[model samples]
Target: MYTETPAVVMRQIKTVNGRRMIVLFSRKYGKISAGTSISESGKNKSALALRPYTYGRYELSKVKDNFYINGAEVLRSYYRIGEDVDKYLQASYVLEFTDKLLPEGEPAEALFDLLTEFLSMMEERKQAYGTLVLGYLCQAIAWSGSAPDLGVCSGCKDAEVKYFSVKDGGLLCEDCAGKAVQDRRLIFPVTVDIIDVFNYLLESPLKSLHALALREDLEKKVRNILRSYIAYHLGIEELKSESLIV
Candidate 1:
């Protein structure tokens, strides 16, 4: 039996010894790794198709009970991502996060589409990459069932002006957050508002985000809360790409 699946090129690592692996985000099967090898020369067609962030059509074939990429064709090279240092790092972070968050072979059409849209947004959009990334993160997390609950204060349920609890998922009204809790970071009103902005921007037309204005102070606070939330859910101390911030 054989299966044909649609996939996004998450990344690729090439070794001098001819060991090559392509990390792929597939629509039907989720994240996967496929081995590919060609002549040592860089002119190999298979090598070209599996480069990082290159969306393409591929044929996965079974060899010794393992799935390997036997052939492929480049659909979009995503050329601009590698042209600049900031762009390259951001793109890498997105791909790395996707690989870590999504499980393999789970059939996620929504995720597949979002990832494809992300790369396109990165390569073509000229606006603030930070805003674009944050907006997508909020939406993507929501889609994955880990969305921070911002509808009501986690503590008081007041649904009014409040402080956010990263350890508790989202905002907490004064009454709810009055009790002492360790590592409970304060979320200022501006931070809450910027979070709303990112949420709103995610739903806004793609054309609008190109000119989106993300206030530095507010954006920073919003991102801090988001990072804390992600760490709480994933139980990670830190993100590797966070250091890549310039």
Candidate 2:
């Protein structure tokens, strides 16, 4: 089958002979491998669309058993991400974490939109970049069905939670924490308001993210929980793009 469709670059590869890139978690095929040629390289590579985090339209076809990208047109390079160091790192974090968390060819349009929105947020202007990313992660995980059950205390039926458990799922009021942490625990309280904010970012307009306040400590807390949860589910120590950030 030959098709021209929108895609995002999840990974880029360079070998002594040939150049290739993997577009995982695509909205169309779920995952894809696109072959490239060196002739496309220069100051302005037509294949920049194959660079990680580059969102654009691609011309792809199945040749024998493998899928190859015969051509691509870059729609948004998210180039501003490279100028700011913090934005750059967080963008890398987003890519690395998402690349692992999403299953290949799983039909995730929400995931794709979520990723582009994050890049768009970074490109425009965001004072609380960390919080922005964390909130997006929270919603993405929830959308992917791995989100922690933050609705009620994981241990007790207390309506309000004073802490969170990464190993278990989410917030656990004092009573729940005591009984639930035999194996592992993360103690924290994420406000119902925070969850609401997460939902908005995931489902609402990407532009709305600019207005939210990012609590620094809570931002880190959310990231910690989401990253651990994703790592646990994927059973991988590192994502291919981890080096792009760390």
**Number of the predicted model whose TM-score against the real structure is largest:** 1
Estimate, for each residue in 97-182, the C-alpha lDDT of model 1 and write its tens digit: 77778876577788788788878888986656777777677767777787766677776677674677676767777766677365
TM-score of each: 0.87, 0.82
| Runs in model 1 lying further than 4 Å from the true structure | 13-17, 63-65, 186-192, 201-208
Q: Scored by CA lDDT, what does every candidate get?
A: 0.71, 0.68
Stretches of candidate 2 off by over 4 Å are 38-40, 43-45, 184-206, 233-246
lDDT of 2 by residue, 1-246 (tens): 898778778777665466655654466876666666634355454556677778888877877767777777788889998889888887787777777766755667877887887788888865777767766766766777775665677676688776667677666787777677345534445666555554465465555667776676655555565566666655645655445543
Clashes of each: 3, 3
Top lDDT hit: 1
Cα-lDDT of candidate 2 = 0.68
